[model samples]
Target: MKTGSLIAMLFPAFVMYAQPGKLVWEENFNSNKIDTSVWNFETGTGVNGDWGTGQLDRATDRKQNVAIKKGVKGADSSCLVITTRAEEFMDRKYTSGRINTKGKASWGPGHKIVARVYARDVKSMGQGFAFWMLPDEKPVGQKHMMWPQGGEIDIMEYVGSIPFHNLGSVHYAWSYENNEWQSWNHAHQGFYYSFKDQEVPNPSEPGYGNYPPAKNDTIAGSWGFHDYGINWYQDRIEFFVDSTVYHIHYLNDGATLNFAKDGENEDAIEEINGKRTGVSEYSNHFPEWHPYEHNMYIILSAGVGGSKNTYGGPISDAAKFPCSVFVDWVRVYEL
Candidate 1:
């Protein structure tokens, strides 16, 4: 039997994320070491140059950047910690850690992915962490669908600049005006949550009034170990925080897959017959051609910001260095 399969069968759960289905695989990070059989480190600026975000950090396999810590305060004694520092490395101004489960494990429809992460409130600035996924397989002997086309699922994202705010989004293909592809032409549905207030926010209109408040407790904890997850299906995806459903995106929302152009329906809502209905252009629906139907692998990373367009904005001298992201555990379930 494969090592990953054996580990799946033998390892038991430490804490449940409360998603539906049988636990099939998990990484508790309790062994005082990362399981290389299930995870791969991604070093340097990344494949798409700057990890597709023009971030300042150069990922490294050095212990200073990625390592497992034992006897962590809030976690079950051990956790995988990825730290980002302001120190220079290999000509890059910053260094951080990034890892993925590409060939070892991949899950498709009818599965739920969850992870327990703790990015402490250290007053750190100009950096962020993400628990996201991407397609595991490449197209066979055909044109490649880059990024937003192949599909991307951001289960959880935390930007230091936007403290206590969590974001979940899906990116997919969109119609282009011509044969040439444009980045803004990508279709996306993003959901936001304010961990401080336990409220959901409008993703499109950032300044809109807050949505209803959730009954759940604030995400703040002694060391802040919270579960972030997603229930993925063939036709929809559900976002979860501490097992509570925060947002749901359906694939058959009676919306068109492609938009004629960007900014046509920036509002994502329209009124008809005295009632407002979601504009098809901005609906959170997935088309059949989308790569969400295929299998995707998990990515856990802590990125440092440098330039104006970098994630979490540019780093300043006021920003603290050696910021850390502690991952208590990661698990997958079969729905």
Candidate 2:
């Protein structure tokens, strides 16, 4: 996504109100093992489809490339090093780990969500590390096929080659075609975008891929951990990085309504889906279609070789056997 900067005037105001304060859930990762109390491993080389067609294998042994390392801590206490191995694909080997709270720590219907995580040495794959939420139930078809309809909330997704920049989005099915592959359908979708000033690139305009790095001073990874957080409130969702607010979307607000209305333009609707379904039918697939009211589970995974490998191409074999994504901790709080 292209990046640009805009300055606007701001006024500060404050008011005080009384509210309850308490911890809802958390995982400090201090123990030598993954906290079973907060997470359960979703083991397996995932099946082919949008949910993730890549092979997601569980790591049996702990290595620097794909293990839980001790002695590493963010700003607070000790940290866990989640590594990736380059050993599965014939041409390339990219290894990573994935953990979720499908049944162990699912959050239902109402709750505020917040997590603090630090990632570095993220291998240059398109599908980098993700701290997101998904519905705990399996959709109608195969277990893996439950995307769009099953519900997905991507709080943070980073494409390795381009660090410091990220994406936050939500996906769900709009309709179906006779309950079959050829008949399956999805309509409107939207995502909130933001980036550090330096990392934005201009579109090629014609027909080429522009690879310009961010225009500002490069942000060093050695600068240490940055706080990535989200406040999921009933009326709106806000995202913050390093304590600075980056994006905000009001639930059922005018901005969302306009996006939905524009999506129904004949050209926009045709581009999204064709003749089999009408535009009105297509528009119903969004969370705005319903209320953003449902429980969700947290999922963290680093994909290696497979179709989802977004780091340009698979890691060269010579570079295999020694890559890792360190995590300080993952915590959730209700506000």
Candidate 3:
């Protein structure tokens, strides 16, 4: 083995103990102008659809939509704010801000990504804010797939429609066909936590406004600003809210793969002429490949529009306009 590799394994403490949770990169947004070197504005109604979920807002690069606000109350210094306004623009009723670190910076295993956000205005229907990641747009030395297949890591997703609920999720291809490879046969597995309370109420509950005749709940941010983060490991990922881990997703759970391909599928096996039928029986579904072992870029956005059942559900008639989500800072640390 290489000397460096052996040292790393033998004295893990020597390498990581010196600077536990070392901050590798950060964005305080203290400058007058956004550092274009690290962030790029993503504007438009998405390339081929309503930005994947039929959101009503169209992203714009206008300063009003995304800008650095100074002398912010409660925050330490300037904050990066993404505002969603209820105005007609580009055939959309609302305009918002979306920015990302597609090629500038990306992180993978052994790293923790976190952001401090003040989302009081993110309350009210039709408004949403998120801190998420996607596979590098131009991954080096490997082929990358598109959405659903490419995979996504949602560190934090808060919607005004969900009231006290917040989300953390990862999307991956569960099963697919060789012929129809570019399909949406994906599995979305994650958990939800509450900003006000530790426990999240069920949607079926009588008082929950998540159902028909949506609730008029307009609760705002949790405290002034809260931290949302994700600790990425080679075999698992942990989601955190306010520095506490709330959920974890394991890459392998000891379940055998449905087909001969090692550990790809988790379905029950069948017999075909005394041999395991594996994935052949299902024409539409095939074993899935582990898709989170690659580099992924960060994305922070605010979206508008949705139904009562979904995040950022239908905009309530009483919902106010010009909602904004403030981000105090973002940092990536070595684990």
Q: In angstroms, how far off is 330's CA in candidate 2?
A: 1.8
lDDT of 1 by residue, 144-219 (tens): 5566656788898776665556777777666522223576767777666556544453343233112111223244
Q: All candidates' TM-scores?
A: 0.77, 0.67, 0.77
Query: CA shift at 92, candidate 3, in angstroms?
Result: 1.7
Relative to the true structure, candidate 1 has a C-alpha RMSD (angstroms) of: 9.5
RMSD of each: 9.5, 9.2, 9.2
Residue-level lDDT of model 3, residues 265-293, one tens digit each, is 33322332232211111111233434567
Worst 10 residues of 2 by lDDT: 2-11
> Which 10 residues in a row give candidate 1 its minimum summed lDDT?
208-217
- For residues 33-65, what per-residue lDDT tens digits would candidate 2 score against the true structure? 777676665544454422353434333333443
| Model 3: pairs clashing at backbone N, Cα or C within 3 Å | 306-313, 306-314, 307-313
Better of 1 and 2 by TM-score: 1
TM-score of candidate 1 on Cα atoms, chains taken together:
0.77
Among all windows of ten consecutive residues in candidate 3, which has the lowest summed lDDT?
Answer: 275-284
* Candidates sorted by lDDT, best first: 3, 1, 2
